[model samples]
Target: MLYIIQTTLTLGFVYSLVALALFISYRILDIADLTTDGCYVLGMAVSVTAAYYGHPIFGIFLAIIAGMAAGYCTAFLQTRMGVPSILAGIVTNTGLYTINLMVMGWSSNVALLKKETIFMLFKHLGIGGPWMDLAIVAVIVIGCMALLRYFLSTRLGLSIRATGDNKDMVAASSINPRFTITVGLVIANALTGLCGALVGQLQKSADINAGTGIVVIGLACLIIGETVMNGKKNMTRNILACLIGNIIYRFIYAIILQTRLIPIDFLKLVTALIVALAIASPSLKENFSLYARRRKESL
Candidate 1:
């Protein structure tokens, strides 16, 4: 029981980073950037490759740089080349497959053999006991939430938010919507990359197919967070929702895995159902309210 709780908590924090990315791109910028799946593998490929080469810490920074570059590619296609936002993400994601393969030395998988990971280093810090891994992930996630909150409150962040709300309005005000959009996408992908980097280091391995359907998972997590707070627009509430939602999702998922109620093969399908239900919840509630009101009137 303790092991299950710790595992769930650790992964919950690790994956919340991807939820943060979707929050910015989907909720904030209102863009469906499909680059998420490939970009995640890209970060993992870079980080694990670097760790394989004996530079575990430097690998994380490199992964961020790589993620930023991937974001720039998508942004370039959208802003300069006149590609549609969704298509731009698809193109970038498609291109990342080859790039990721190259980064992994043309291999489909990579692992750290007798190598150190960021988690191992944190464990050695003498601050965390048996839960050192969970502690490290918790600190990183909390710090990210803090930085993201602070960033969203700044002038540039406001511009980015405004661009999401009304790009034309921002442009009319001479705020340069193009620049803001580019910056927003760049930052969002950076978070995704950081997530992949940390996940790779934690697991000490990277696989080409590991990131499949990751965007859906991230969106699911974000929507779960939004639903928890009743769709409130307060920045603090929304951010906390990100943390709370992931933990809740992980807890439920852990329970399912522990109980063997569903086969491992069907977990993804169940996850999709959960996401669909969460997405439709608002409409469902409104329908129920109307039905109850009609019954009351008849009575």
Candidate 2:
């Protein structure tokens, strides 16, 4: 049970970065960038490849740079080539598969053979003792959350936010909506890359198909986060929501799986159901509140 709890917390922190990425792209930018899955794999491929070469620490930086490059490609196709946002992401993602394979030496997966991961390095420092993994990932997640909040408060970040809210108004205000969109996607995918890098190092392996359905899962986490928290009007609350939602989701899934409430084969079905309920939660809450008010009026 302790092991399960630790695993749940570690993964919740690792996966929340994806939710954070979606918070920027889907929520702030209003762009459905489908490049998420491929970019995730690209990050993993880059990180593991670097780690295999005995540069575990440098690998993370490379993964983030690779993710930024992927984002630039998608942005180029969308802004410069006049491609639709969704199609641009699809084209970039399809191309990333080949790039990922090349990075993995044309292999489907790569594993670290007794490499010194950041987790091990930190553990050697005798900090957090038995909870080293949890400690490292938790710190990274908190750092990212804080950085994202600060970034969103900056001038350029405001431009990106405005671009999402009203591209026309932003353009009229002398802000290049295209530029803001490009920067926004770049940052969002960078977070995705960081998440991928951390997960790869933690697991000591990377797979070509590891990012499959990641966008859906991220979306589920994002929607779930928004539903779980009230007054998400502030940047801080919304940012925290990503962490809170993933933790809650991980807890629910782990408990159900551990207790045999759901078969392993039906895990995907359960995820879909959770996502649906989360999507409808706001409406349900509103209706319930309305009903309560009407009942009081009648009384």
Candidate 3:
């Protein structure tokens, strides 16, 4: 039980980074970027393959670069080809499936058993063998959140946020909304790729399907965070919400797994339902309040 909780938190922290990427494009940019599913897998494949070649750190860097390329592809379709934003994302995502396969060098996947990964560095530093993975992941999560918070406070960062808010207004200010969107996508995808690499390293394998429905999972995290943190527009609150929501989401998943009633095959469906409920909760609450008010008026 304790080990399960630890595993959940470790995996959850890596996933929270992906969720943060979703938050940047979805909530901040108001764009539905579906490239997450493929880019995530691409990251894992790139890193694991690189590790197989005995360049583990370089593998991580390659994954980030690959993610950035995926981001650029999506932005290019939207900005240069004049495709709809969502459609552009879909196109990039479709292309990435092939790209990921190529990165794996015609292999279906890669497994890095007995790998010397970032987690190993924690152990080398005397962080304790049993707790090393969790400790490393926790440090990475905190570092990312802090870096993102600082970036969002910068002038360019403010412009990016503004672009998400109102593209036309940002354009009117001569900020070039397309540039902002492109940069935002690049940053989001880069973080997501790093997450994938780290997670693959932790798990000791990278499967082509590892990133299936990743966008949905990220959305679930974002919604859960927003609900728990009340969706405050402030930077600090929003970042903190992502962290808290990630921990809670992992705990919920752990609980569900413990229940013998839910088969492993049904897990995806249950997760989807949970995400749907989280997304609808605010509207449901509003409707209930309106109903109570109507009853009072009638009385």
Off by over 4 Å in 2: 280-299
TM-score (C-alpha, index-matched) for candidate 1: 0.93
Against the correct fold, how does model 3 do in TM-score? Answer: 0.92
**RMSD of model 1 against the true structure:** 2.3
For candidate 3, lDDT tens digit of each residue in 1-299? Answer: 88998888887888998888988888889999999999999999998988877787888899999899999999988988899999998999998888888888877888887777766766777767787888878888899999999999898899999998876687678888878899999999998898888888888788989988888888888778878898766988888877778888888778777885677678778778888887788799999999999999999
What's the TM-score of every candidate structure? 0.93, 0.91, 0.92
Q: Against the true structure, whose lDDT is highest?
A: 2
lDDT of 2 by residue, 1-299 (tens): 89989999999999999999988988999999999999999998899889999888899999999999999998889988999999999999999999999999999999998888778886776778778899889998899999888989899988889888886798687889779989999988998998899999889999999998788788887877877786358889899888888888889889888788888778777787777777788799999999999999999
Write down the lDDT of every candidate, Cα atoms only: 0.88, 0.89, 0.86
Give the per-residue Cα lDDT of candidate 3 at 145: 90
Model 3: lDDT equals 0.86
Off by over 4 Å in 3: 122-127, 281-299
- Residue 200, model 1: lDDT of 95
Of 2 and 3, the candidate ahead on lDDT is 2
Residue ranges of candidate 1 with Cα displaced over 4 Å: 125-127, 281-299
For candidate 3, give the lDDT of residue 92: 92
Query: What is the alpha-carbon lDDT of model 2 when measured against the actual structure?
Result: 0.89
